[model samples]
Target chain A: AQTVTQSQPEMSVQEAETVTLSCTYDTSESDYYLFWYKQPPSRQMILVIRQEAYKQQNATENRFSVNFQKAAKSFSLKISDSQLGDAAMYFCAYRKQYGNKLVFGAGTILRVKS
Target chain B: EAGVAQSPRYKIIEKRQSVAFWCNPISGHATLYWYQQILGQGPKLLIQFQNNGVVDDSQLPKDRFSAERLKGVDSTLKIQPAKLEDSAVYLCASSLDSGRLTDTQYFGPGTRLTVL
Candidate 1:
């Protein structure tokens, strides 16, 4: 079984500042994928970024980037130039390359302060 | 492209009652997923389907919950004798075939269920 863990329950960051949300996972599969999703109060789940285990280089989406350390089973999301729109519940997810089930972490509530 | 679609944005029912939710995946998506998201918690996979054929349902509570993707496009989930713990947001998501390692999933707005 694969499990994702987000140690932080909540995080706050000043607008335009940078913030990093930590995530860890336990998976026996050598090939898998990691993802970060954002859900605002509206309740829509939006994909923020994704990282492939085989790729040594991390994934980035404009202001969003990731620091993935496969050996340590660590994958953290970094949000640069955070804005008010970034305020939402963030989730860390894991999925095996050949599997369809996606395991998710408890989630972290991000609050962007102006 | 239109994202996943789920009906009944919110539902309120008493315990022991039956309820159902519907979902329509993206036009060409070959994989669909159903998840339960409890307040203050992350979403948990309830079931997954690949072109109307179930791929996984290990975590689903079969005793009271059932789901089907009859046509390989749209899906429905039903719960009978609902319990208080069944109160949660039900989300639907779709993605391209899992064979593509880079396939990303798109999610619906979700149906919020409250069992009284």
Candidate 2:
């Protein structure tokens, strides 16, 4: 069984600051995918960023970037220039390279302070 | 394109009661999923359907849960004799395909269920 772990239960950052959320997974499969999802107060789950295990280059999408260390099974999300609107519950998820089922970690609630 | 849709934004029932939730996937999507997310936890896949056929249901608690997708379009998940531990938010998601390489699941608002 594969499991994702988000160590930070609650994170707070001031507007314009940078914050990084840590996530680690246990998987023996070489081919896999890592993802970060943001769930706003509306409870709508939105994709943040994605990383393929075979890719060496870390993936970045606008303000979101992932530091994926494949060998260590560590995938972390870094939010830069954070804005107030970025407040949400961020969840780190994992999927087998060939399976669509996503295994998610305990979410981290992010609060953007003014 | 519109995202996945789920019905009955919130539901409350007593222990041992039964409750059913409905989900409508995105148009043209061939894969649909049902997930259970309890407070302070990530969503857990309950069942998955690929064009109305069961793909994988290894994690589903079969004794108390059953889900069906009719004609590979819409789906319904029912829980009979609900228990307090069953209280959780039910999320419905759909992907363009069942194959992981091209799968990007879009999730719904989810139906929050509370059992007393």
* DockQ, all models: 0.86, 0.93
Give the clashing residue pairs of candidate 1, or none: none
Pick out the ten consecutive residues of candidate 2 chain A with the lowest summed lDDT.
A63-72
Residues B11-62, candidate 1: write the lDDT tens digits: 9999999999999999999999999999888999999999989889998999
Among the numbered candidates, top TM-score falls to: 2
Off by over 4 Å in 1: none
| Predicted complex 1: CAPRI docking category | high
Please report the candidate that would top DockQ against the real structure: 2
TM-scores, one per candidate? 0.98, 0.98
> How do the residues A1-114 of candidate 1 rate in per-residue lDDT, one tens digit apiece?
788999999999999999999999998989999999999998999999998899999899999999999999999999999999999999999989877778899999999999
lDDT, candidate 2, A1-114, per-residue tens: 999999999999999999999999999899998999999999989999999999999999999999999889999999999999999999999999897999999999999999
